[model samples]
Target: MEHTILSLINQTNRNIFLTGKAGTGKTTLLRKIIDTTYKNTVVAAPTGIAALNAGGVTLHSLFQLPFASFLPTYGSVPLANELQRIENRTSLQKHFQMHKNKIQLIRNMELLIIDEVSMLRADMLDAIDFCLQQIRRNRLPFGGVQVLFIGDLLQLPPVVKQQEWEVLQQYYEGMFFFQSKVVKEHPLLYIELEKIYRQTDPVFIALLNHLRENKLTEKDMAELQRYVKPHLGTKTDDNYITLTTHNAKADAINARQMEALKTPVYRYEAKIVSDFPEYMYPIDKVIELKKGARVMFIKNDPTGNRRFFNGKMGTVQSLNDERIAVLLDDADVIEVDRYQWKNVRYRLNETTKEIEEEVLGSFIQYPLRLAWAITIHKSQGLTFEKAALDIQSVFASGQAYVAFSRLRSIDGLRLLSAVPQNGIESNEEVLQYAANKATEGQVQQEWEQGRLEFLQEMAMRTFDWVTLETAWLQHSSSYSGEIGNKNVYKNWAQQQYAKVKELVATAAKFSKQLDGYFRQGASVEYVCERVEKSVEYFIPLLSQVWYQVMYVLEKVYYQKKVKEFVGELEELSNNMGEVVKKLFRLQQLMALAATGKDFSKETVSTERFEALFMQIVTNVNKQMKQEQLFTKDKEEETPKKLNTYEKTLLLWNEGKSIAQIAEERNITESTINKHLIKLIEEGSIVADLDKLFSKKEIEELSPLIDALEEDSLKTVVEQTQGRYSWDKLNLFRKVYLGKE
Candidate 1:
């Protein structure tokens, strides 16, 4: 089965879907395929923790989806402006160019392996399909791209509203459940992996199989009890065995399994389940912890999987009597009160600075550091070299099994204690969860079926006519001289026109498909129902296209042309004002008419109007003749030179104050004053002379007074005590009013 799956993945034109039980090496196979086949590949995990474990980016991040928000139901359809912007962006341009290059390089490629496919809701898959299709510009499924989907349908399904999921399920129903007859007809490659790799103990494997089949016998229960027994003295000397909530059993188990150091481990070196107090430690204490200081810090939130420095690593930077500053190699430096560090013991290395430099250098370039202690959820896609697991602790879920199975080999597994079976609930809880999911899936399937039927029917009826009309319009426009020679200009116009037609046709088709799919029955598979419900997803795209098309035709074609004409007239008026003055007058009349204002009743004879226009034209011609003559004469002469006072006045007019002129221009203040006085005497400048006490020239002096008051108040307020409130308030008022 594995070979078949691997072979399909290797095929140039095949997309493979693999489904099976958990611990069946689905992810393992995916990793192998990625490592072996595709070079320029992206491994996108659904969750942040999963991505971290897989050493890949998360799906949401890759899609640029809003964090913690529902996925957008409608696919992205770029507007003309947005498309242009995307074309201009260096990153996107590079990405597109690279993909084009890759296509040329490979000619063909291997599968796009998407692991945990079951966890992907129908809508999410549709979104992925939409993006791929758009980028490749291919009409076939996933842009005719080969995709490998691996997941067990029985496992955790997508997290979404049940109704939304149902809609998506309906849209993809046909593809989800490929009947043998249908499979033969379409020839879709499907492979199932059966062998369980993690639960190698025959007895253990048998018991799990029984439990999975809901056929656990009395012997099975007895075996489970025996398997769950706790081992004595397994905990490290410094590490205490502690339980949090029954829900955290998995975390406790994993925490206990971490390898213990042999270096005289102090009780403070480890903590079982301790909560770090927020804001209790001072900043200085955080900076005092030296390198080689062994420390174990507890993360209170089970889901808070901060990679580094969330109370994890410890290294000293500086120390004082009251506080110590410690630096986390990954997280920023923090200071804690010296009193807070009293309980923790560490032998500070004298050569801490050298060690710090070495450690900091190692991590200086990386974005984030590897986490020392991680939650089981964070361990999903990770395969550790060695893992220590304890199932006896609190809050253990089925996820514990999943985490344990992540290790590639059994030799890497270090069991801290026997796996606990006590908290295992009756099959009812698990069955209920599965039933709810299945029900949601059914709803989605029904919606998808309905949508498909509607699309098919609509395609046959309304869409055919719409598409025909669109083709005729496109043909007419192409042959017509309306489109110009510029490729960008022509393409932009065609796209605007085509988008509307495309939406109308797509909507009609979807409507027909929905009608056909749901007309038959309701007891369809959950996946089918989910796909059917996705019909609404296409509605927004249709609406946007319709609006955009109408806007382009009405505004771009009609209004934009009018505006362009007006703009050209305005430019001509500015350049050839005298000759084009009549054009400006006509524009004013048009503007008034546009505003629904009455025009003047005055009328001129046609001959008189023509004579006036001729006179204006003659005047413009005469001015142009004089300008040409003046330019030739000016070029033949030397440039006029300014006297020192005139030069100083020019600088002053250019916003150089007397003081600045003196300092920068290397002139005396008196000389600058003399220049200013001469300019004023010449009547080229205006000022109140006696008050020309630069400070007394009221209008000119106001700015300086305001500045002085502002500075004086600022100094007084900064130096003043609380008891001087009245004086400070007075100073503030005086400064604001420029009365100081």
Candidate 2:
């Protein structure tokens, strides 16, 4: 059954909910999938602690979302109040302000794994969905990214304030992630694991299953009553840790136990090697340990010998600078080594055009924490051989279940207080959902259907030009050149952008035609004919026309000798080159599909892509040389290219307004303004501000630009309601600052 689940995850793009009871190896399965999957993947968790446990980043940090409750912003429906409305607007604006690299990272993702999803609120999931849709520009759930949810629904419930729920109940069915609007519309395939590695006692397992469903009998109560006692052992006992319902109580117990210890205290400080943030520290920066203190292993043995595992209990035998020996329950003492945890961040590699993870820093420390007491919330994901439960005051739903489920067997459990029967049950809605989950037969059928549909969808989307257009737009918006060669390079880039835009529009229409054929149940040969025809039509346009332009840009880039522009040009060229390679790959795959061959894992070879790329480069170079040869023949009659600054200066001296000069020269007003700014900064010419803005407009904007807190032009435009364009504002700022 686990193998079938792994196959579904690897072979198809299906959204799945992978769940099981405690100790069912869900976390272990996640690590396996992350190591083996071929897709570009990212992992996110609901909170920082969970993120650390899952070895991923927080969902909020990954999405750049504010730590505020989100309400739906679509449609004309009003929010609960004006404050909520304002916050939603601000969050939307922040989304717009995301860095291009971060945006690209989200766009490149193929699969997203969310851990500890039981604690994910319905509204928070919706917020994540909205952010993905806006960033990827796709209306499909999670913007077409396959999502895998991992957590048991019976462990812990999402935290929601009473007032927040009062307002949210109008929009959502309940507070669980499964109740979110997106999940409700596109239901996830359920696959629950069955094997329980922590407990081997069949009777204890049956009792736990009954407790999970809120169906415990009188006999089960009699079994639990045996464990009820005033105390499990003395404070010096190393076998049991108190699981309380509140953090303060746990803290007090741990503090009192530490004070009672008369052994000498030894302080150990972690080594921070680099850029790990303080909030994300996995362990304490400084740990104070006594010789007799009880400790739990916070990390697994790094050497793979499995000498000790996370959550294993031990007592400190000896502490020194070089080694710390812990005595385990089996009367064996082993030296614990300091383990290193890396702080990783994602980045897009310009050379390979792929997203990769970079280790920002590392935290090296001994993997132990005091285990005298711990809160039930933090006890999640930890296995215990013996636990003393103080959950009589359990306030949250499923808290008692979580506390009890952490134990390996009924024999090791010691109840310090009577179980709170009212809070010991799962949510009724959750029970119904679990009962109605699709059986294995249904899931297998769905997996077969989904694999077929995934192939067809991938084939159809091969013709889509959205990614190409997006890459072009991002590059054009961020490209800037040095003053010496700014105009020439800028103009060339604009011309290429216009050409790419036209090509993308044509590609969009062709894509829709293919979509129509698929909808109309066209013959495989007919669809292949259409696809082949598109290949013939688009290949030359891309390789010969588009690649030729890039070729020219490359030549100009080198001829200009501008060092700062090289990185930008390389990025843009590689991005456009990837589009061409994809097209060639599409043609090959279609050819294979026409013959009824399996092309599921097929991709165009890099050798073939480079052949096409070099073919274009060679032809373009030959043509340019021929043209230059012809120019050399007519050198006497040819005119030298005028410097852009001198030409703009001539126009400025001729009493031509900025707009008129821009129109006559066939350049943008913004470009013209940039030219003027360069001229002023170089002390070439300084003239009228009246032609650009009226006296009242100038007076109004001058003070705002002067007194502005930040050096942002976009801020200036926002304050004035965009009445002034970016070009005019930039020109004014240059003049005001330079003159003063």
Candidate 3:
């Protein structure tokens, strides 16, 4: 069946869908095709964590859907400006033009393979198909693209039931009919690969197969005894042990596994419903000292008590003490203590900081390694290397069968518990409904008809080119010697062999059928044409042109408004420039004197500088108050409350640009410039005036600037004394003369 499916895939002109029971190797085959044939393939899963597990991007991220939101933002997608930002490389540009430009930048691509197809909603698939069609400008679905959908039918269905699933069901029903017919008519090379490698015991395999067939045998009960028996001897490395739910089996099994290696386990418990205590020290302090540390935590507490009791499981995070962290399969970080650290268990190296940064700052302390765990749901799709399954728990219809058959090789399995046949219920109503919907027969007919048509077309297209090539190879003297003869023989052999095999296979498979089975009127070209047309018909329906047009119109309108607004803002700012200059000058001088720079023998003291600046600020407030520029209540307020202008003045003194101070304080820098303009109006502070400073003033100002830059008052004082004459300075003379 695998080879026939591969042949069909090689010939199919449009998209293909593959579906089967769970654990059917659909994903495995899809990956094989991608690795061997498709080079430029992008694989995506529906959910983020699932994508991570599959080593692919999520469908939501690929579609650029907003996380945690229902209403999708559409219309003019913005192009990330590479010249404007460094991180824009991965950023998806919003506009269609930009998206096209980015697509054009890609060098080579052949296919897009989507896995977990059963979980995909029809609308989401349609959306993806739409985007591809528009970008490629081809009259085919996904722009004449080839897609392979791989998934199992029995696993969890799409989450959105009403819209997507219903649409998908209808579409899949049509495809399923086509697939089933192809399998029946053709020599479909289906490979079941029933060898359960994970569960090696023959008895266990028989038990599992029986259970899968809905027939539990007595041998299954006997096989489970090995796990249940009490041990009388020292534990052998290969000995199997069973832990019960009441016995706290999961944790005990984990502990025993670790103890076999002579390693200690670090245990921590947390109330899942409440916050972890603040004083509980972090895990890093304990695990750093030891290697191969086994850690277990309570996953669920059924009692609902405040404290943890039973129902804990052993889940180990391999710790890399060199990196000071433990690595979880989900790529979560846990800083571990020294004593409980496990070095041998983890793969350690210098972390890939670049890859970490690419993932939008998810802090992964250590790189990932393959993990082993029993997630009942996820285990459905996998065939393990070895398996130890316990099916003593209640089986809900198909659950037991699905769990048992997960083992591929008979010898690779160990059935830890017996299946209870009495547990199986024959729900006749449910069975009847399923039987009615089994449309598998109809699907098979359509698929066979499609395959026959495709094969007939290929056979008709075969020319005598191979015969001509073989003749040429034989006659050409340039290919003389043993190598030439060998090459000629190889060409002739391959051509003759292929021709004979195709004729014999076709005759053996189809000759037995009656005249009506051939469907003589139905041509392969017609089938191909029908498939092509079906794709083209959906192209226009999926195009998002209206959304794009609306986005473009909105963008143009906003650009015009922004241009006008910016112009008015610029003009207002220019008018306030002079005021800003004057205020800055006064603030700078006062700031300089207040820093204790000795200007002269009678230079202003630091106290006097501060007092004078405050007085000046007070006077400005009073002036503004007199003009009633300030809105006031009838009650009197303090001078501090009245001094609104001082906030702007202080901002200037702190070396803030006039524009910045205005924005922060929510006032116009122009208004601030107006106050400075007033200072110029009164000739209190000069505009663009570089006054010739006395040596005393320079000495004082330099030290203050140095102090501010260095953030040290003591250093400023030392630099001041070294540079200036203390004997002649007024403030210095006062101290030296012993005057109060």
Candidate 4:
């Protein structure tokens, strides 16, 4: 089945719906696709951490989509809340429309891989589909892009509010991502991943499978009750996690555990630099780091080393102004540095077809969470060695199941609720869906056959080039004469583009000479004569008239967005028609001038011209952003092109010493050193041997660095005690075996 799916991946037309229970190698398969696929692809998840785990961006970040719990700001208007909602909808649509880069990415993309699809609402999915259709200019679903959704529908349901769900109810069959309008209509092939990678014990696995399937027997419950000991040692001292249904209870437990520590709490205010939004900030704004506080690592170590995984537990050993020491359960004291969690919004460059990462902002701090206890909802994606569950408050269906499944074995759980009313709370809707989905094999087979038939019909049908069916295809031809065609589209486009350039050059020169105004006979006659004289240039152009054509081209040239001119020509009309229209527009402008029309009045002054230019350019520039011919024509007051972290990476790549980079960036050398040290810790940059220190020096210095008891600058400085300059050691470490 896996091999069949791999073969299916080679085809560009089919959407795949991948699902399995928790720890079922779904992420593993996605990682493989990301590493191997040659297609222009993107990865997005419903949440920030999920996106980070997939090495992608959030769906909201990718599409400029709004999380639809509307915050109204209205006073005294009739139906003001509804009006505000409408206004918000329009604004969000405009937001999506404005990001030309993102729009183009949607249009040009081949495969879009979305993780944690269950958390994705139906409206969000529709938002993506609508944006794609708008950008690609094709009504065929999702701009004809194949999307891969990896998530377990049985684990988590989309959190739709009562009113929102009421609104969405009319449109969708149900709230599952598979039930989303686009996915439901579009024949997505479901591929269930059967292998469970995390839990190997057959008994535990069977219980989970039964529980997930909503077929948990009375025997299973009795067996579970046997593991529910009255007391499971000292919970305060042990590393056992507690799962509660309510946030308040979890917070109380955490607070109680923290208060048990007699040590004074050290309050550290997180330094704000970048434009870090609330959604992306991993830790608390005011981080309270107390000695012996139980903390969980929020980020995986960059080097793919399992030493400090995202959920790894450690205790704060000590803290100071510069650094904090952490002691892990495995008898290792690792120096933790202030980590940077980026909230990046990505866009695909069409010209080069390279994916560019735009840092929206970032949260820089130690990736630690106060993890004494957490709510079951928050613990959805996490696994624990041992867990304590307070199932007395399992208000929602599947809540008990979710809390139970967090543990690897029945032995790891110490349930506080001795007896609940029902054996296991399962949603009736989910149970019904599971029953119906059991026969999904027939549905998928029929869907595939129908899909193949549709494609075959398109291939065999008589060509009516303008129809929506063939619009997704770049170019189409009549049924006959495959061999006789000599690339008409390219040939025609080039010839017409040349004509436009000539006409535009004349108009450009004439505009400057006229002191920004056109006169009726001499200049108008000159422009009109130029257009009338070119016979083949201004012929057979349809859809757009000459005024719009000439007006748009002049705007394009003036705005320095020349790369998108060809695309604008294509948008106006096809290649041959495009050139003719360009010529016609100049003729119309000349005629208007002759008729004493002051079309250039509001556009005469530089300020007005700039305003007019901005209006025209914003719309056209957005379209051009998708065309790979990118330019350096950045907008006024655009944020810094390169972020501080990106700049550090660039300077390091150029082989500039840390000091030189520090001087160039106008920051302290210590800051640059810290940044470089972070790169090393993340395992992104390895030390290059002999670049700063000899192999003998490295061998001698290895133990000295290790004896400091943590990978931190403060500890290193403390150990050296000013005998050796820290810069020498930093330089030495930077180039020491960094290449791997």
Instruction: Identify the candidate with maximal lDDT.
Output: 2
Q: For model 4, give the 10-residue run with minimal summed lDDT.
A: 456-465
| Model 4, span 1-740: residue lDDT tens | 45445434432356777777777777778877766554567889998867866778888777776656321122331233442232223344566655555655665576788998878876677777776776777777787677888887766677776666555565666666666567767757666777877687889989987777767778887888886765662276687777888989888888888899999888766766677667655667777778898877777776676668666777899987677888876678878877776666667643233455677676677777777888888777666677888878777666777787777677777877674535665666655544433234654564445433332222222111232212212323321242322232344434444544445454345334442322232444554454455423323222223334434454455443344443543344323232332344334434444454432223122232234334444655665654424334444446669877778988988888777888999998778766777666667566555553457767767777656545555666566676445766665555553422
Sort all candidates by lDDT, best to worst.
2, 4, 1, 3
Q: Residue 692 of candidate 2: its Cα lDDT? A: 56
Error at 47, model 3, angstroms: 2.6
Best by TM-score: 2
Clashes of 1: 88
Q: What local distance difference test score does each model get?
A: 0.41, 0.77, 0.39, 0.61
Regarding lDDT, does 1 or 4 come out ahead? 4
Shift of residue 305 alpha carbon in model 3, Å? 50
Query: What lDDT, from 0 to 1, does candidate 2 have?
Result: 0.77
Clash pairs (backbone) in predicted model 2: none
Which residue pairs show collisions in model 4? 350-628, 351-628, 546-585, 686-738, 687-736, 687-737, 687-738, 688-735, 688-738, 689-737
Per-residue alpha-carbon lDDT of candidate 2 for residues 1-740, written as tens digits (9 for 90 to 100): 76667657655679999889888999999998887665668888998778777878889888887766677664433455634432343355565568878887887787899999999988888888888888888999999999999999998899887767777777888989999988988889988888899889999999888888888888888888889985654256747899999989887887788888898888889999888778878778988788878888988877898888888899989987667889988788988888888877677654334457778888888889888888898888888998888877878767878888899999888888765444265689888888756778887887667754664576667767766777667656655643665445566677777787888898888888877876786766777777778878877777654564566565666655556556566556766776765666566655655675543223323456677767777777887788888888888677767798888988988988888899989998889988988888788776456665678978898889878788788888889998877977888987777552
Q: What number of clashing residue pairs does each candidate have, in the order they appear?
A: 88, 0, 56, 10
Q: Residue by residue across 497-576, what tens digits does model 3's lDDT show?
A: 34434433443333233122335654434433433343243223212221222222233333433443333222222212
lDDT of 4 at 292: 90
Ten contiguous residues with the weakest lDDT in model 3: 348-357
TM-score of each: 0.35, 0.73, 0.36, 0.59
List where candidate 1 sits over 4 angstroms from the true fold.
Answer: 1-3, 19-28, 35-42, 52-56, 61-110, 151-157, 161-188, 194-199, 212-214, 230-234, 237-374, 381-400, 403-740
